[model samples]
Target: MGTLEDLTDALARDVIAAMDEIGDDRFFEKVSKLLLDMSPTTQEAYMTAIRVRLAERRARKYVEDALHAARAAKAKAPE
Candidate 1:
């Protein structure tokens, strides 16, 4: 079994790979342009929504790291 750090790093790499497959920078640029073109109120709402979504994604990654740590600890524990 992999160490917790190793598993976490692998998962992060996988996430980056998936994002790359989806054209991450292009998506960000598009969203940024859309946000810039919106009215102030609309831009505020859109930015808030984007921030929430990003926070959720970060939270999910944190959970994944925690799970990996738990699994590694369990494996290393003596019977």
Candidate 2:
């Protein structure tokens, strides 16, 4: 059997992809509940992985938006 980390990470990625494909934002919560029934430790690890990935995605978007705005402002400024 794979380590807990590997299993949890893989599950997290698969759950995210499934959620995207199904267009259900609450899918993670459902999966978390299911995992809890099976194993609380696994559920917690999966939740942590999901949260970290989602947070990173949000952080990246913020950085991208800021960069775009900075470039637009620079373009508009006097040369």
Candidate 3:
């Protein structure tokens, strides 16, 4: 079985991706329902965790894009 951390990461990533695709009103409804049912502490913890995961995802994408651009430039350079 996957660890708790692994499960959390996967679920959060999936939620973030879905939010990206959904309209604002639908996203607000779904997320508000999910979080509003939680206790205050639980809500804070989940928000913190998702924010961390999103930051990591953005950083990874930035690095990957930079590397790809550098590699393409290198390939096009004269030997």
The lDDT values for all models are: 0.59, 0.92, 0.66
| Runs with alpha carbons beyond 4 Å of true place in candidate 3 | 1-11, 21-37
From the highest TM-score down, the ranking of the candidates is 2, 3, 1
Error of 1 at 6 (Å): 39
Compare the candidates by TM-score and give the number of the best one.
Answer: 2
The residue-by-residue lDDT of candidate 1 on 1-79, one tens digit each, is 3354454344444544565798683354355466568555444544455555557879999999999999999999999
Among all candidates shown, the one with the greatest lDDT? 2
lDDT of 1: 0.59
Q: Number of clashes in every candidate structure?
A: 0, 0, 0
Model 2 has an lDDT value of: 0.92
Model 1 CA deviation exceeding 4 Å by range: 1-21
Model 3: how far residue 61 lies from native, Å: 0.6
TM-score of every model versus the real structure: 0.57, 0.87, 0.66
| Tens-digit lDDT string for candidate 3 (4-71) | 44655565666777877873424534653576586554445555557787689789999999999999
| Residue 4 shift from truth in candidate 1, angstroms | 42
